[model samples]
Structure formats: C-alpha cells, structure tokens
Target chain A: MTALEYIRCIGESWPTTKERAYFEALALKEHGRLSPEHVPEVYHFDRTMSLIAMRYLEPPHIILRKGLIAGIEYPLLAQDMAEYMAKTLFFTSLLFRSTTEHKRDVAEFCGNVALIKHTGQVVFSDPYRVSQYNHWTSPYLDQDAEAVRKDNLLKLEVAELKSKFYERAQALIHADLHTGSVMVTPESTQVIDPEFAFYGPMGFDVGAFLGNLILAFFAQDGHADQVNDRKTYKEWILKTIEETWNLFHSKFIALWDEHRNGSGEAYLPEIYNNADVQLLLQKKYMTDLFHDALGFGAAKMIRRIVGVAHVEDLESITDVSKRATCERRALDLAKMLLKERRKFQGIAEIVAVIRQF
Target chain B: MTALEYIRCIGESWPTTKERAYFEALALKEHGRLSPEHVPEVYHFDRTMSLIAMRYLEPPHIILRKGLIAGIEYPLLAQDMAEYMAKTLFFTSLLFRSTTEHKRDVAEFCGNVALIKHTGQVVFSDPYRVSQYNHWTSPYLDQDAEAVRKDNLLKLEVAELKSKFYERAQALIHADLHTGSVMVTPESTQVIDPEFAFYGPMGFDVGAFLGNLILAFFAQDGHADQVNDRKTYKEWILKTIEETWNLFHSKFIALWDEHRNGSGEAYLPEIYNNADVQLLLQKKYMTDLFHDALGFGAAKMIRRIVGVAHVEDLESITDVSKRATCERRALDLAKMLLKERRKFQGIAEIVAVIRQF
Candidate 1:
C-alpha cells in the first residue's frame, strides 16, 4: 500500500529572515486549497517558525528542468501545465470572485511584500540597470548586456511590464513557476516553491514557465554529443511551447464561459450577452494576454543569461564558449520578443522563429 | 483671537451600519493629513462610535452646488481644486512612494469596502441594469432610461470602466467628489464630506468634480427665468472646467518632475533618463488619465440622471418638461463622451463639445 511521507520545508530567504518564507508557506497553504490537483499538499504550517510540512515526492519524480537537460520528453507536460495555469490563475481572478472577496485576498497577499520587492528588483529592474548582482558570460556576452542597458525601446516595454506587475491584481499567481519549481514523472506533474506568490499579473506566471523552457531548449545544444544529437528533443521543446500557450488560451476561455453567469462582477450576464460580444471580448482579452506573456517571457529569459540568477540549464553546460553561443541566440530572440511582442499573433509564429534561430 | 468651529459627522450609509463610517473617519484621519489645505481638518476620530469631528466652515461658505444653482461664481475654484487633486492623488500614488508603502496603504484602505461596494453597485452597476432604486422624471425620461439599458456600445465601455475602477489601485481618491462635496466662497474653498473615501482610480475623483460641473452647466437652462438668465454664469462654468483640467495636468506633471529623483518607483530615473522618453511617457500617462476622467465623468452624469440620485440643479426646476429637455442634452453628451472620449486630446475640445450640447 502506498503511504504518505512528510517533508519539512523551512523558509530561508535573502535577508535570512523567516518573513518571506512565512508568506511562502502561507501562500502555498492558502491557494493550494483552491487547486490541489497539481500543487503539493501542505500538511502543516507554523507561521512563527516559518516552517511548512508538505508532501514528499518519491525519487522517481525529478525536477522538470533536470529531465529536460537529460533529453527526456514528457508528452502530457503541456496539457498538465495548461490545466494547472488556467485553473490556478482563472479561479483566483475577478472572473470567478466578487470585488469584496478579491480585494480581501489581494490585501492578505500584499503582506508578501518582501518577495514581491525582490522580484520587482531582480526580474524587472536589476536586469536593465547596472547592478552588482548582474552577471554574464564574461568577454563573450559583455557587449550584449551593455546593449540591453542602452536599448531604450526594450527598457520602455520593461517599464510597462514592471508597473503592470505591481498594479494589476488580476490573480493570485504562483509567482515563480520556472521549470526548477516543477517536479514530474511520465504521468504526474506537481508545482512547488511558490515563495514569490502574490496577486500579480497572470502573464508573469505564464511567462516564467515558458521562458524557463526556452532557456532549457537553448542549453540543449551544449548538452548534445555523438550519442544524443538532441535534435528531436529541441523539436519537442518547440512543440511543447506552442501546445502550452494554445491549450492555456482555450482552457482559460472555457472557464470564463462556464462562469459567465456567476457572481463575477467583471462581465455581467446582462451586459456581455450575445455570442458576438463574448467572441469580441474573448479575442481582445486573449490577444492582450498573449502579448503580455510574450513580453514578460522574453524579459525573464534576458534576466537569466544576463541578470543575477543564472538557470542551471545554462550553467551545467560546462563549455563556456559553446554555452555563450547558445545563450546569445536565446538573448537575441528575447530582445526581439521583448521589443516586438505586439507584432506576434500566434504560438506557431513563435515556433517558426525558434526554428529559424 | 480667531477660534475654530467643529462639526460632528457620523456615517449613515444605505445598510445603516457603523462600519462604513468608521472607515470614512479612518480614511479622513489617515489621508487627510497629507493635504489639509483643501480637505477639512479632522479634529477627532472615534472608530467604535463611527464618528468624525472635523473643522466646521462658518457662514458664507455655502455648498458649491447650491452656489452653482444660484448662478454664483468662484474665480479661484479651478486653481484650488487643481492643486488639491494633484497633491492628494500624486502623494498617495506609486509615482510618489515605493511599492512597499503603496501596497501597505492600499491594503489598509481596502477595509473601506462597504462604500466601495455601494459605489460599485450604484455608480457603476445599478445604472446599467434595472433596479427598484433607479428613478427619473417619469414619462419625460422613461425612454432615455430604457435607452441606457439597451445601448450595447455604451454598456461595453461601461464594463471597461467598471473593471478599471475595481482593478486599478492608482491612488487614494475622494470616492464621491461631486459639487456637493465642496463648500466654497468668493475667497476661500473648503472641501468636506469625504465619508466615501478609498484607494481608487484618480479619474474617479477628478471626473466626479468635472462631471458635476457639466450637470450644473446643463441645468443652467432650466434655472433660467426673467432676471439673471445664467448665460454668463454658464460660460464661466465652461471656462472653469477647461482651466481645472489644464491646471491639474500641469501641476501633476510638475509634481512628477519634482520627484523624478525621489523614492517614487513608477518611472525610475535611470531608465527614463532621456528627454524624449519622458515626453513620451508624460503624454501617454496624461492622455490615458484624461480619457479615464471623461469616461468616468460621463458615467457619473448618466447615473445621476437615470439612477437613484437626482441632482438638486436639475430637480429644483419646477417645470418637469423643461428639466427633462436639459437632462436629455446632458445625457446625449455624456453618452458621446463615454464612447468617443479617446478621440479627444485636450480640455478645449471638451469645452467646445459642452457648448454644442
């Protein structure tokens, strides 16, 4: 008989204080109850201690990033991720709750300001400006990082995203949803490490996951050898990116359609009544979300290569010259995506661009 | 010795509870300290008793709306109001403070949800749909009320504004900043009755003031009789509207410029260093704010006409037919403003439109 195993996860944050961790445990336990299918169950939480007792995934379950690095393919990854993102984001948004409930939750999560500030600093602000924390592949990518600082248009887009992240209480997001934050087997996917969870733009969450995957795909070139060319794996990565966005779009719309008559004050049934109106709103909303995701995803990618926190997928490549080449390709694409995201329409076009690179 | 008079104001809202009043008092005490020049000075606050004891304006400081109805003018009205709006809104926004400070204050003010709900329903919701509370000049405005319910394009725009009202935590706004909210004289202007205060879109506050002025302008026709035709007074009102917006725009930009190197995080100085970029951002910000004010102003106008609360300017007119004629013109202009506000670039165009109406 399968039994439960408990794991103690204590909060140790940047300032070496329990505050951020307390919020992390609180966020996981708080939002985990809302959607339990993909998130790990929180067994116990001690606020003062900044400790959390959660489920222990067995050895067979590896971090999604590591699996990607090993050229492993999880066929159901896109479907599972789409469902996870859609449910977690949709249920927490104004589409599902009244203003009273939404505001209450927003205020409660705003207490997680420590992590939110950290994110606003690292992912949004520090990447563009010269900071002691910022790093890159020296000599090879120095000019590239300098270029990022000087690109006024890219900086302008980033400022918009930064404000959106701070202002839009669109949803309670699992604020850090990179591949390293996910654990999976062939049949199972579990989301974890929501230390940065707060009411932020939903696109930030979607972008984080997709941007990390893009990082992993670029690193595949460095990992390839005579035995494993990793050509099929790279193709799989592109297909997964396309499928994830498309599925999320459809699933998010389906939830909205289902809850059209509920207490959600965003779109009253008396107002958005006709099929044509619904179609119009849906298209407009998805288009905005699509662009938001692309812009944010590109920003996240740029930060990984040039900002403080380097992804293991790139770091583990070992060969500095080859790794820089792969990184430069990702960097150039991210810059394009960040600056010209509005011009992009569908994920297929994005996939086409990836193939070109 | 000059002595100050005091007034005890208790909150008595729709549901007949002390909670809304407590928040009102707290909001006054909390945000009132920021700009006491315009807002009435709060002397005491008893939260449990749901009471606020504030400075009492002596005689000659009549309600601004009553002054407007009597064809009285305050030459300094636009200047004082512009400074008031710019100071209170700017100091409390992310443009003047860090996210940490802003979020903390946002969460604190979210406690005033009772009035926020009342506003969301009456100002934004109930006006769009049928409700027993909604009333108009029966038989005269019956068609106009019904037309509001059937106007799909108008309703679409309302949905957008309503969502913005809910989602955007732009600044601390005097949630009900109508003409009645102010007590004015030839020399001194004292703003009072902030019982419906909370953190909301700045446009809501600015729009409330301007929209009520527009109502007064329309009602000039009905209030006209044998002596004092109110024609010249109406022109002064139009000029006041133009001056108010233009002054507020300049003063707001001045504040942003003054604090560009300060703690405010909206437009970080490092990224937005260049003159060209600053111009681009200012134009974009002011444009969006102008449109938001226009849209919200139009909605406020619509609700006053067809919704539960009828303004004294229109209601005091004895002839129902003549009053309805004025109301119809205001309603038509408001509908156009709501739908076509984006096309407007400056306050001069708006003043021109008001003249045509």
Candidate 2:
C-alpha cells in the first residue's frame, strides 16, 4: 500500500487486506510458515483507506520500553539479538545467495517497501513540502540541539564503518523493534505493533532496541539521586547488553544447526566446510552489521532530542548542567558507534563500553 | 562554409577569394587601406574540392625552411612573429575584440578549422578506412607502425588548444603562420597564406611560429651533420630565437605607443603613471600573451615527439643515447616554457634564455 493509505488505515480503522496478503506470501517464503494469528485481517472502508485488525498478543509479556524502565535485564540478550539478525538477514535470505535475475526481482520489490521509504522521507524531507508529522522538526539545531542531533545522525550514517551492510536482501522486518514494540518476560517474548514493519537493513531493528536502553540509562541522572544506585544501574545496563548478545548468538546457532537442509553435498561446499570457516564468515557479517546498527542508533538518539516530540530523558533533567551532561554522554556514545563500529565484535562489547562511558 | 568545403577549397587553389575577402576587411580596419594583393582568393571547384590562387611572392622572399637549410638566421624572429600575430589577430579584425553577436558570426565562419576531426574520419572511419598509411614504411622512423599511428592520433587532439587561446582577444592573428606559410627577406616580411587567419589569442600565432622554429631546429640534425657544423648551427638556432622575440616586442610596443586611443587615463597606475596607463595595459596584455605562447609551445613540442611527427634532428642520431639526449633537451625547453611563463617580462628575455637551453 502507499504511505498515505497505510497511515490513513492505521488512524481511522480502515482495512488493509491487500497489504496483509502481500506480507503473508513473503513471510511464507522466508520463514517457511504463515502465522495467521500474527498477521492482520484487512477490510476496505473506502478506495483510499482500510481497517486492520489483529489478535493482539498480551503478556506475561512486556514492551521493550517497559522492560527498560522496570530494569528487567535478560541473559545473553545482545548475542541472541545479533545472531537472530545475522541469520535472518544473510544466510537464510535469497538476496545474498540468489541468482542475478532473482536478486533483481527481490531488490525491486524491496525498493518499494512503503513503510521504510515513508518513514525516511518523513524524517528527512522538508516538512513544508511534505505532510508534517508530530515527530517532524528542523535538524538545524543549536549547541545542545546540534550535539544530540549530530550524535543521532552520526550513529545512523556510520561514516567511519569499514564495510557496508546493505548488500543483503531486505525482507519484511519489524523495523521499529524498540521497547514499545516488544512485549517480553523471562521465558517468553512477543513482538507487537507491526504497523511500522517494512523491508530494511536488520541492523535498524537491533540499533533501535539497544539505543533506547542506553537512553534510559543516561536518563537515570535525573530519575535517581543516590550515587551508589547510579553505579549499580550503569552496571545493569552493561550486563543487559552482554547477556542479549550471548543469548541471541546461542539461539541462532542452535536454529541453524537443527533446521538447515545440509545434504552434506548441497551447494557451496567450500563455505559449509568447517566450524572455523563458518565462524569467520559469520564474524565478517556481524562486524558489518554492527557498523550499520551504530549509525541507525545514533539517528534515533538525535531525532528524539531535537525532533518535535522531545524525549523525557534529557528534558526531565530540569537543570541545564545535568541535562547537558546527559546529552554529552549520549553524543559521545553515538560518536563511538560510528568511530569504533568495526572494533565491536558483538552487541555485548559495545553496550558494556557505552554504559561505562 | 562547412569543414569539408573549407578543406576542399584549400587543396585546389593558390588564392582563395573568400579567404581574401575575410582578411581584407580586417586589414582595412587596421591599416585604413584594403590591399587585395596581400590576401589570397578562395574558390569552390566542387562540393568536395576547392582551390586558392594568389601572388606567390618568391626568390629573395624565401619560406623560412629554405633559410634554415642554408644555415641562415634572422634576429628577433619570435618578436617579429608575435607582432605580426598580435596585429593580425587582435588589432586588424573584429574576431577577438567583437561583441558577442559578432563573435558568434566569426566563430561560425571558422568552425571548419579543426584539422583532427576531419582527418580522423578519413583515416579511421568504418567502411572506407584508409589503410595505405597504416604500414610502417618510413625508413627514418625507428618505432613500429601502430605506435607511430597512435602517437599521430594523440597529436591531432592538440586542436583543443584553440579554445584556450581564443578566449582572450589579443590580436588579429594569422592562425597558421608556420615556416611553409611565410615569405621573408632582410628588408621586409610579408605573411602569406591568410586562409588560416582568424581572430584568436596572440599567443597562438606566436606559439605556432616559435613551435615551428623549434621543430626546424630539431630537424637540423637529420638535415645536417652534428660533427661538421653542430656548434655553429646550434649558435644560429639560438640567435634566431633571441632575435625573434626582441623584434616582435619592439614592433608591438612601437605600434601601441603610436596609435593607442587612451585619453591619458590610468587603468594600472601602480605599474605605470596614470598618463601612460594604456601603454601599461598593453604591456600587461603582451605579458599574458607570452605566457599563453609558452603553454601552447610546450604542448606543441611534446605532442610532436611523444605524440606524432618524429623530428628529423633526432632522426639522424642512430644511437638511441644521442637521439634521446636531443629529445630530453627539447622536453626541458618545453617544461621551461610552462614553468617560467609568468616570469617573462619581455620577448627578448624569454627568447634569449630558451636559446641557451
């Protein structure tokens, strides 16, 4: 569906039957399963608008935002997230492995992914010419505004990253998989609000999740007064990052080992040979993704500070010195995201270092 | 007329009526007299061929080549050539000094001047490519046929120099005043073959003359023995260069002082008193012309050696060392042309130094 149509459908309970159909076909091809319960049912209200209704999965679950606020740290979270992303984005997709003709077809399809294009346009294009959004604001910022905005944009651009991560096939991804989008607990995790879903670099989803947690940790300066408590909170942020990466890596490897159709003679024996080769290839792909993640994370951080809907993290700090300090730290982290992207082996390492700063 | 028609006209006659008419108008503006005898007449015999007819002023008025062969030399030759060029190109015609509208008309008239484009089609075009000249039949050339042919093609692109030289309206120049086109005597020098005459930069005319002289000097080794008359021959070449520039500068300044129409207003008071600003402006113009002459001269020299048209001076040197030495010296002169172009204060100084090199 077109961007305007999608937005109208979301706001006015219009039907999105055609959009759901397209996603279902794609999901079946990529995931080998069509989760009807997870996808929306669409009904046309008018030629230009549609209503989308879905089975909203509730918790024993918590959105990523609530989890961040509640300090609900998960084990090996960063590793698990990275592994899920690498497998989903690279090995399983036809984009990196397909014939030229098939790759072109997929590229064309992904190019028109409306949600991705729409969000980018809304964020980057002039608001006077484009339909203004609540999040739209001038990127030309003052000293404080400039600092935060630049930090975010730098994270998104990843100017210093050694390798590009956009060569892989972009599937229909839940692009905004931040705290508010994810509903999770200790044993079970549920993702909701797929309205912002689109085909994009998988690093985007990973970056959003990690970026919001970093934001919350910095916001603690205004929220908590005890110096000792602040140090503990900071440690928790580092632990959460390390645990996320470990969990994501273990889970992804297990999935690949159990489900892969390795006939021991399938195509590309050279790539599939031994554990060392596999690890090397995986490491290269992970490193590239880390750079892209840093760039996207910076973009999100900057937008929240100078964008129209300012975040409460720095705004809540009331005192200019305290607020500036929080912002300077966030900017520093964002800069590090771009400058040290290649050095980061896993999400845990990056998160661990960022929280300490 | 188109390029084809122009080439056809030059190939068929001694004096081109059209060429004469064009130059006569220029002469009338400068000398306040129209001497038809001084210009060639142009005529079209067919769509593909035409001819020129004119008084072939002969004997004591020998072409520059005959004098070179006889080991005779002229003093201040470069200066004489530069004045002739400056007078013809800048002063005599509306070619360089014309308004935009007038310039457009003149440019259209001279559109067929590019020799390379016309030769390219005749030499390399499909269906009727000329193969007779493809073989390395030149007993004098040490290089293979393909290398020589490629070098020749490169030299042809030097037509680009026209654009650079044409921007400054410094003189009414006889655009092709090489040795073959001029007839000279001790008392007077009459520039013949006005077919290539156009409103162009003063340096083009100056460069063409100096460049041809350099070519002639280099070709002397093939025409004469280095052991028998090398020292005396070299001295003559050097003197010719020094004398050429001196005469050209003296004549140019004389003309400016006698006829310049400035009303005692200074354009460059810092360089000269306000009362003689026009003379200073003229001097500045001559300096610029010298710089351009140097650049074009260098390009012309380099193109002939590494490019096409192997000079006879090096051709006589059977030993590669001697030939390469001559080539190296020529190149050094060419480089000096480029490097010291801006520092040149007068024609005599440049000519004198270049002769030593």
Q: Candidate 2 on A154-211: residue-level lDDT in tens? A: 3223311111112122344556556565555565444455544533456676677677
Fnat (0 to 1) per candidate: 0.49, 0.00
What is every candidate's C-alpha DockQ against the true complex, given to 2 decimals?
0.59, 0.01
Poorly placed runs, candidate 1 (over 4 Å): A1-3, A11-13, B1-3, B11-16
Provide the TM-score, chain A, model 2. 0.68
Tell me the TM-score of each prediction against the true structure. 0.95, 0.40
Q: Chain A TM-score of each model, in the order shown? A: 0.97, 0.68
Residue-by-residue lDDT tens digits, candidate 1, B66-175: 99999998999999999889988999888898989988988887777767878888887777788899999889999999889878788878877887788788888888
Residue-level lDDT for A31 in candidate 2: 30
lDDT of 2 by residue, B9-29 (tens): 333333344444444334333
Best by lDDT: 1
